[model samples]
Target: MQFTSTPRGARLARRLVSHRLDEWGHPYDSAPNETLTLIAAELAANAIRHGHVCGRDFHVRLIECTSKATTVLRIEVADTRTERFPSLETPTPPTVDDESGRGLFLVSQLADRWCVAPRVGAPGKSVWAELELNHG
Candidate 1:
């Protein structure tokens, strides 16, 4: 899904993710569902805040995969600004009074694994995170 690089768009992306998770058999109140939605919101918000360009939009993709041993939920958010590369190697902790620098911190804490990479054949990058699920 693609959305305008605006706050409203970011909010919509978050809501849609919750709905999609419910449709995929994870209820809205479930841990995986709630955590993934928060992650998606943060990613989308970052794309808008740091990568938005005039007349350009952001993109989001969600996928659920089940292999022989595990099920995983993958979330990806892409933006058109290629110069601003995000690093997941060392996320800084936000100050107690800081209201804004905590998105990636939350993602780092909530997601099992996450990274930012250049988008293929595109003028931008994608931030992706994956959450592992136990089927038992």
Candidate 2:
């Protein structure tokens, strides 16, 4: 899904992702739906806030890759900023009475696996996260 690269775009991304999850049989309040929605909102907001390059907008793609034994939902957010990739191995932010800097930690808890990669065949970066579906 394409977004406007503004605050409204970030909001729309969250809502669109929720709607898509619902369409995929995960209702808005379900565990997976809620987790994806929260991750989408935070990542999209970060893309807009930290990766915006003037009029260039960000894009979000949700994909499900499955085999006989497992299914994974991949959440990818791409932005136009080539140098704004996140460093996951960086040290954690200090916790001395802070009101900010906790998004990635939350993501680490929700996502089974997540990483940032330079966009292949493009000039931007993509932050991708995966959640494993409950197969039981």
Candidate 3:
């Protein structure tokens, strides 16, 4: 889904992610649901604050894959700014007093795997995270 580059849009993206996960059988309070929702929130907020371009919007895509042993949910947030890709290496630890710069750090901690890549057929980049859930 595409969203305006604003806080409200970021918020909506998060809500929709949670709702969609619920539809996919992860309840609102389930670990997969809450974790992915928070990932969406951070990524969407980062897209708005760091990736925004005038008159341009951001996009979010969620994909679920199920196997006999596990389920994987991949969240992708693509934005129109190409110059500000997050570091592929470990994110530097933010200072205690720093109020920002921890979004990707949190993502790294929560997601089983995450990365930044060039958006396919697009001018910007996509930051994506994947969480694996065991069928229980």
Candidate 4:
């Protein structure tokens, strides 16, 4: 999915992710749906706020994978800015008085695995998160 680089777009991306997950057998209220939706919201917001390029929009991709051992859902958000990639090292803790800057921290906490990489065939980068689903 591609969206305009705006707050509304970020919001819509989040909602659509939840809806898509629900359609994929993860109900709206399921842990996987809610968790992946939140991850999408944060990444989309970051792309809009930090990765915004004048006329370019952001792109999001969701993939579900199942194996004998576990099921995983991967969410990727790509933007047209390559110079401002997030730190691959441990995210620095924001000061107590800071009003923001916790998006990636939250992602690191919620996602079983997460990374930022060069956007394939594009002049930008992508941040992706994956969570292992519990079958119970």
Candidate 5:
């Protein structure tokens, strides 16, 4: 899905992701569903705030893979600013009083694995996170 690089766009991205997760057998209130949605929201917001290029939009892709052992949900958000890559290596937690700067930190805590990569053949970067489903 493609969205304009704005607050409204970020919100729409999160909502759509929630709906998709629900359709994919993960209920809206499920732990994995909620966590992934929040992760999507943070990445989308970062794309808008840091990766936004005038008249350019960001993209979100959701993929699910299931195996005998586990099911994994992958979320990718791609934006048009190649120079402003997400710092997955050293995402230090923000101070308690700081309202911002905590998005990536929360993602690292919630996602089983997450990273930033160059958007294949695109000028920007894609930030991706994966969550392994609980079989119980």
Candidate 6:
């Protein structure tokens, strides 16, 4: 799904993810759905705040894997700014006490694995993450 690089876009991404998760059998109140929504919101917000390129929008995709003892949920967010890849540690938010610079930290806490790669056939990068779903 493509989303404009704006706060509205970020909200939309989170909401749509909730919808998709519900369709995938994880209702909005379930752990899986709630987790995915948080991941979507953070990734989408970063895509808008850091990866935005004027009129270009970002794309999100969800891939499910159930073969493992725990299910694997993959979230991919692609944007048009390849140079502004997310940093796992270094966040220069211009100030020490600022409320920013903790997005990836939260992502790390939630996602089992997360990384950024060049967007296939595009001039940007795709920030991808995987969440381990609880089978019980």
lDDT of 4 at 124: 95
RMSD of each: 0.9, 1.6, 0.9, 1.1, 1.1, 2.5
lDDT of 4 by residue, 1-136 (tens): 9999999999999998999999989999988998999999999999999999999999999999998778999999999998999999877778899899999998998999999999999899999999997665
Per residue, candidate 1 scores C-alpha lDDT tens digits across 1-136 of: 9999999999999999999999999999999999999999999999999989899999999999998888999999999998998885768999999978898989999999999999988999999999999776
Task: Kindly report which residue stretches of model 1 are placed more than 4 angstroms away from their true locations once superposed.
Answer: none
Candidate 3 lDDT at 108 equals: 93
The deviation in Å at residue 120 for candidate 4 is 0.8
| Global lDDT of each candidate | 0.94, 0.86, 0.96, 0.94, 0.93, 0.86
Alpha-carbon shift of residue 8 in model 1 (angstroms)? 0.9
Q: Which ten residues in a row have the lowest lDDT in candidate 1?
A: 85-94
The digit string of per-residue lDDT tens for model 6 on 61-103 reads 9888897478898899999997887765533434567678777
Name the TM-score of candidate 4. 0.95
Compute the lDDT of residue 106 as modeled in candidate 4. 87
Relative to the true structure, candidate 1 reaches a TM of 0.96
- Candidate 2 pairs with clashing backbones: none
Tens digit of lDDT per residue, candidate 2, span 9-101? 999998988999899888989988999888898889889888999989999999877777777878999998998778877427649697766
TM-score on alpha carbons, each prediction? 0.96, 0.91, 0.97, 0.95, 0.96, 0.89
Model 5's lDDT to the true fold? 0.93
The list of candidate 6 runs beyond 4 A from truth reads 88-96, 134-136
Look at candidate 3 and tell me the lDDT of residue 67: 99
Number of clashing residue pairs, candidate 1: 0
Which is better, 3 or 4, measured by TM-score? Answer: 3
The CA-based lDDT of model 6 is what?
0.86
